[model samples]
Target: MNTIRNLFPEDIEELRHLLQTVYRAIYLYQHDRSARLEASMRAAIQSCMPFLERFKPHIPAYKQRYIELLKQPDRMAPYDLIICFDRAIYELHTRLKSGEIANRLPWSKELRDLLNERQEPAPESTEGDDAADTERVDFLTSGVGASRGEAAGVARVILDSVALAKVQPGDILVTPMTDPSFLEVADRIAGLITDRGGLVCHAAILAREFRLPCIVGCRNATQVIPDGEPIMMDTTAGIVTRIAK
Candidate 1:
């Protein structure tokens, strides 16, 4: 498994090469069809300038890199590159499914069977026995106050993307950490708690953006807090209290 995992970087490099080749081919094909169409594509790409300018403040690193790439004479439009990448990923998937690529991995039969099994849906949450004991505090944890203010909501422990759907509007999002993917439910979450992260981490940045009460770097938060439990977070004090019920 370690050997197979180590090969992932090489696979990604191959994908990158595939993306570039596909992008170049499409660009040439467009140019051959009509120079006017090619010019129009460039113009369309330029039209995204205002949007990117506004978006730069929120995600400066990505926007800046994209801008730099656009400045290069040979660069294609951002959407075209995205499309090429999707195509490359699809091709890789096809090869893997056809046993033309992944079959070369020295994977054990157990591992192969596990990978082939259909993913089961997350289990339904049951109300805890203390659901009615709202006056009692079940647990307390602290961390860095990445965002300010106080919020009280039901804690929804999310370990991965598959568990994200369990989060509802105004819930306190509890996880080990966060990434850009968490933005999908950003608007719906009332507070954030992470087991790992510093002030400048992705969870912290997202909390600041939504002005949600956030406590990060609580090493045992996800383990201590039970799912569906009511919790109170005070970002100013960097404390989280699990309320009974």
Candidate 2:
């Protein structure tokens, strides 16, 4: 009763806002895959809890707060929505970084084992200003300096390796993030976009490798983006704007 009395509705407004956004992302990504989403959400929560216990500097503070608040007797205010969804996102990031999905992705082990076997460099594709400017109309939004230079093309959302044919030399590659498996076409692609990428992820590594325009940490980018639409991609500025032909 005391806690409820103490509460000001505004104190929780941000938390409520965060909850809506985070839940929406989860639903968008998992709506069709209920069993998988439930199991994955459970796994995600478990995976994040221990990271707080281990205490890494890289661990975001809101995550630590979430774990700590969950232990309290009285209700604490909710954190922001980014933190909520980030809990799951970070878990997925950790899993991807750990290489658990590498074996599951067909394009991975071969690249790993064949590092010495393959001598030919990844192919590079660059076009004139007129061509790139023309492709800029289709993308929705981009981040700050995600890729270098400019480009325009069809988008291929590479959430999983099952969609290999979708990646092509001129196609814009979008994914939650990239693992080694998505690299099979990295050299052949024009641009890249990701929802949860940092300097170490395959998206960054291969973007530099192929010199493709790349954007990282565009959360929920895949949700609004449609397939086969023309887009202008600017990786250096981390922007993806639509370019209608």
Candidate 3:
């Protein structure tokens, strides 16, 4: 697809209205409580499914057109650029399907800029952006020591349940909370550290069964420990310290 430079005011406004509708649909689907309401919510979510399947591929083409228009002296109003970009996204969905764009539209920073109001390039990563750069921060927050033992190993910050593939043997698993889904990684981790929970939490109960050093309710363990960095898990004292890496 070609590049986009600018967008028209009406296009932008229309896209914003559509996006608001999508958001409202998602909110309804998530908050639907009763079975009757749940069925309605599911229908609402399904109604918007076509948008997800379409439009993504056409982004590249629409973006190219927008860019070309921007180079012209009589282009659309400057303020309408974001709205136009959003409109293009919706229009593309209306024209194409997911398969059509699946391999066609590779996401890039430039594409993101065109899709949003901002046209600036993404900033480069710095020390502040990377937790690994500040690996020297070693502090301990107390929690319920469900399993008693001390183990030191690299930290694996698994914030999402889908990231179980990142778990490796003897790595310290750090997360906000653990459910039954986390049991898949229980065998590979040397210890478990979580942001919330108690002795009765799944992580605590599993730790005892696995005989792994477990620390629950360590409010900042996941944030303090950089993924892949060395860490000392002192479940005996319910503390996790960032080790110099």
lDDT of 3 by residue, 186-221 (tens): 788888889986654446645765678889888887
What are the Cα lDDT values of the candidates? 0.60, 0.52, 0.57
Top lDDT model: 1
Give the Cα error of residue 165 in candidate 1, in Å.
1.1
lDDT-superior candidate, 1 or 3:
1
Q: Quote the positional error of residue 189 for candidate 2 in Å.
A: 0.8
What TM-score fits each model? 0.47, 0.44, 0.44
By how many angstroms RMSD does model 3 differ from the true structure?
Answer: 16.4
lDDT of 2 by residue, 1-80 (tens): 22312446553443334333434333333324455554443443343344334332333564445455434412322223
Model 1, global lDDT: 0.60
* True lDDT of residue 52, candidate 2: 35
Off by over 4 Å in 3: 1-137
Q: Kindly report which residue pairs in candidate 1 clash with one another.
A: none
TM-score between candidate 1 and the true structure: 0.47
